[model samples]
Target: MDSAPARHTGQNGTGPAGGGALAPVHPAAARRSATAIHPPRGPRADQARFALRPRRVHRRGRALPLFTADALAAVVTATTLPAVAPPVLSVAPVLLAALHAQAGLYRPRLAPSALLELPVLAGRSAVLWCSVAAVTAAADPARAMGWSALLTAVCLQVVLACAGRGLVNELQRRAAVRRPASALVVGPGAGASAVAAALHGRPEFGLRPVGLADTAAPAEGAGGALPLLATHEDIRRAVIQNSVGHAVFTRPPEADERTASLVRLFHDHGCRLWLADPAGTAKVTGMRLPHPADQLWGYSVQPLLPRPTRPLERWAKRGIDTVLALIALVAAAPVMGACALAVRVWDGPGVIFRQERVGLYGRPFTLLKFRTLRADAHEAATRWTVAGDRGMSPVGSFLRKSSLDELPQLWNVVRGDMALVGPRPERPFFVAKFSTVHPGYEARHRMPVGITGLAQINGLRGDTSIEDRARFDNHYIDTWSLWQDLWILARTAASFFRFRLGGS
Candidate 1:
């Protein structure tokens, strides 16, 4: 559904005092905007892609100065004490950094404070010195730190570390006041407005509220002096146009589907996400606060880590796909040959059909299949075919029903054009059409296209609800594992052998 035009606020902080009626946008408006926003062809297209590339600096860059501060403190402590050997200086700094990282000291915080970190800093410092003493004793008993020396070293390290971190925090605060990062307060009601107001009133937090994203309902007063973004398109445009770096949710993201859907959108755009509990209702909603000290203007806040990209596991999945796909093609070569001969004989010459289908990241690739029907380019691309169609020959119907026609897609999997398991690829026309109508339909492109998927196994093939299929596809991705892929393949194989007529 299209949303209303975004509402803006005045400099005096006066805005709409109540929710306004949402106006519907033209259905094709989103599609038109998408096409217009993307450069067709030129140097400008390359520049646009480069500008929108996922930014890795947002989280890591901010943590670098603190890491440096901790490193400096470790080095100073090692050189200042006779109990610490020269070789210990190098190892101590590395060890201290690891310890602090485990304690979450290096995490990006909206409101950073050295004083609040004292307890954790002191504990980690003590552990570092104790470990150093133990290592020294193991190498040379005489060089080991004594009790008095160890105590002095711990205290000195804590003091220096705190002082160094304190200085870094002050510098960061001053810099933030000068140039705050653009942010959006997500959620509706008075809660969102209060949080946005807090961010605007307090510069130390380093986030300037640029807008309010309230997909669930109209935000009261449009979150005070900020435009209300009620649609995904509006929020996306705001993020790109204003260079928004932060997204603060007034409630837990899991509060509802409308709110939960925004997570993938923001993460894909490289925005740092946070869940802020201003009403102290997170506990009631079963939201777990892992870090108590992390806050934004007295409101409990926590960073929402992005979905983990298991590189090793994904590499393993690719390896399995290549190996198994190659093996399957070899094993089924005889059956594929017989099917191809039958198609050539019955369908009058064209044995192997090739048609363009949308694939990973919306890239188009020619999909291979035993000629199931003899349709012209326009009919094949734009028409939807199903089993028992009068246009299809007996051979085509049997091949599709038995899924013998899909054997060629194993080659696609082997060539890395598709995964053995993922959301099924569709034609470019259908992809564009479905995306605008169904929520989360476009998100299916997040993963590689597949031959068979969760939706297929659950009987969503042929004519089915696009919305449900999108839901299943997203769920599969969210909980995907190598084992799940294997299981889906196993089930697909079993069903194929049974000669199930679930074909499209």
Candidate 2:
């Protein structure tokens, strides 16, 4: 059979080491060549040689599969037993299975030994059996025999499955001693060369680099004893002829379409395609694959807590806020009414103060508060109010110190403009300015602004450093939880009383 042709200019429009333009193979031609090379035969004569194929080589440790199969068998056996029945036995096996799975005991990479996992399975099963017996003693002593019988069945199943998997693993290990997969490393660039080197270094990975397909003339004795098969255009043909099962595209081909088409061609021929990261080949550690949604967003917006309960939970929270806000507003009506009367008597009648503040997602909203300042305070440039500011009306100072000034924001929360706990909203001007100074500042808007937050509990209030305040805001966003919010609320109450007693 004629050797398959390669397509595309090697790395930089250079020919193969032998100096001939590589030939391109049509998809049909490549498929025919693969078939022609491997004629079907009966069972392999030598197990060791057959085991050399990549598909047959199980690089992942042997123990993991054994442990998993045994654990599963134990759980199934326990569940099937009639004697062990109750909240104790039923929930225990399920919980242990979940925990074991989470601990990576079932993963192919962490192959644990059957013997090791068997003890763990037995221990969990015993715990479940004991719990079941205890429950039976309390509920009905007569059921104890049925429960014990079920636990015995579970133990037997676990032992049998563990032994079976161990035998299979031993067989596979013996097979691996035989056949190994032959590989052709197409080193078109630094990335490709690096991949080739890695495969060469890890021979147990079942990759045999027959030769490198360099477009440039092979350096003097480049292939060494390995054959320098073909160049760029002949890559596909060469890969097909040599029975390559993996093609790594380290660098882009001369034509984008050609590269894309080549990847598809490889895939059609059952070759695994691995593309090098375009961001440069610096090895990355602890790299987590992003979810499909994360990929779509181009960024992460996960909360520290398990995804916010559910829609019903959110609605419940909103309902609680609305009911509480309404009741508080009603209870404070008399005081607010009296305060209005006092303001009318003392400062000539604007009892309510309305100021524009940034709200959710930077939207502007009118913040309602008791008129603590003279109405004309904004006539000059807007400035942050400080402790004992002369602009504060006599009545306003008492309102501000007591936090009665912020009670009206219950309305904001009720109106859905704010949450009960989140980063405190910023003034639109500050939001704009700070966002420019801090690139990640806008991430705070991912949740609705809140009436109070971690910053408030930490004594981060008016005129505090914006950077320090932002740090608290980010901390709240990152570590938000209903429990954390409750803690902050408790602290806020303590601070409120302390502030009230201390006065201005």
Candidate 3:
């Protein structure tokens, strides 16, 4: 995106040591500064990390009471129609589960009410019992269930399901009051702090405020012993360390790039991000409120991330990766062997230069490239570009320009260290440097690093703005699909011989 507004700020937007804004210091100094803050640890910290698990009833847990009630209802319905009881009892619960899933009965919500969902239950039960009657008729025409039997089944299902779920809701409310999920409040102004305070005072909401992320540094004791995360790094470190599962942002995520960056960061770490209307006054245009209740205290919560799509697409990605890597490795073996020989003959040794590059999820792996320069370990690690170095080695120039230097990374793809198409992997030095300097740089790790990527295709390669490269990479991941991967692969292949060394 555009250049980051400004560099590091302490809590409440204050500069470190009264500088108004801390100047960009050396990376080593910045690392030391980041290391200085020691967040609270021990039993309380452990509790914060583990609290989200079994913290409240949601998703499958919410469905449990309904399932139990439906089972009881199934018995009653079947007994009424003794002739078809066996088949009805065998299929009713399983069919209801599928139908309820489609009707969003399994979807988790912060404050769910069984009583409010009575209409949905009744409607689904009607459809479900009718389906059972139709299936029984098809299976055995002589023993088809009657209209009276179907009506009884539907009525019993709704009443029994509602009764069981009402009991579950009451039990769940008590449990939530006892143990709540850890939450982080994010936004500018006192709105975030106010919502956090309200949660602290009320235990029934099932949210325990662990910290706050705001544009300005919190006033002394404003957070009430909770941590303040002013910078993205601080936010990331805090979220990971404290096991923060929920994020409550007072403003809409679309308010600015910073808020958008927060969405990517939380999504990468798998946190549930929520946009909160703390005062419940502001409303974004074209936003539809969820049915029933969607309030946390006075704040209205809007989830930032959409529910994940079909699992088959994700499974297809792995299948694509493995299959394509194997084919590419075999197909390119001869070319790689030739490049190795060329390097050995001309460069005198060290045909393959192995360096640790940051990959998916900030994990490091050894990336293999043909040695093109005679730099020492320190120079290799810290050097930014060698596009026009006067090294005077024709062999090195040929390998770099021809893109033969990257052939060995096909092995990385096969080993699952990389993908055939994704953001190019950067050395650990640059990963650290860019992650701090560029907003959303670390978010690139959300997808596997690759040798060819959208950034390279768009010409944001060597010596380009790190911020723009991060932008394109994140965009690619955000819109990633199997077809997109195939298209990138096709473009890379079609341009393989003619592809410039700029992307190198």
Clashing pairs in 1: none
| Pick by lDDT: 1 or 2, better one | 1
Screening candidate 3 with a backbone cut-off below 3 angstroms (N, C-alpha, C), the clashing residue pairs are 11-217, 12-216, 12-217, 13-216, 13-217
Candidate topping lDDT: 1
lDDT of 3 at 79: 75
Q: Tens-digit lDDT track for model 1 on 1-504?
A: 001112211111112222212221112221122232233468677776566554532532557788888888888888877867789988998999999988889877877778888899999999999999999899989888889888888898888888988898888888888888888889766667777777877888888877778775442231124566777766776777667888999765644446667887887778998888766644433233554268776787877653435789989988999999999999999999999889888888988888887766466788888888889999888887776678889999998777788889999999898888998888877776665455456557657889898888887776567676777887887678998898888778777776443342
Q: Which ranking of candidates, highest TM-score first?
A: 3, 1, 2
Relative to the true structure, how large is the alpha-carbon lDDT of every model? 0.73, 0.50, 0.66
TM-scores for all predictions? 0.54, 0.44, 0.54
Looking at candidate 1, what is the lDDT of residue 211? 71
Q: After superposition, how far is residue 304 of candidate 3 from its true place, in Å?
A: 10
Question: In model 3, what lDDT does residue 17 have?
Answer: 16
Residue range with the least summed lDDT across 10 consecutive positions in model 3: 12-21
Residue 102 shift from truth in candidate 1, angstroms? 0.8
Q: Residues 1-504, candidate 3, lDDT per residue (tens digit)?
A: 011222322111211111111121211111222332244477677764464232322222556665676677766666777657475677877888887777667555666677788888899889887887888788888878788777877887788788877787778778878878777788754566666776677677677776677534432222134566667767776667666677887654533345546776776676776666654533421233455546666567655443224569866877788898888879888888888888888888888889888776566799988887788888777775444457727877777666777888878888889888888887776666665455556567667788888877775655566666766887787778988888887777767656543332
Q: Considering summed lDDT, which 10 consecutive residues are worst modelled in model 2? A: 1-10
Error of 1 at 440 (Å): 22
lDDT of 2 at 307: 20
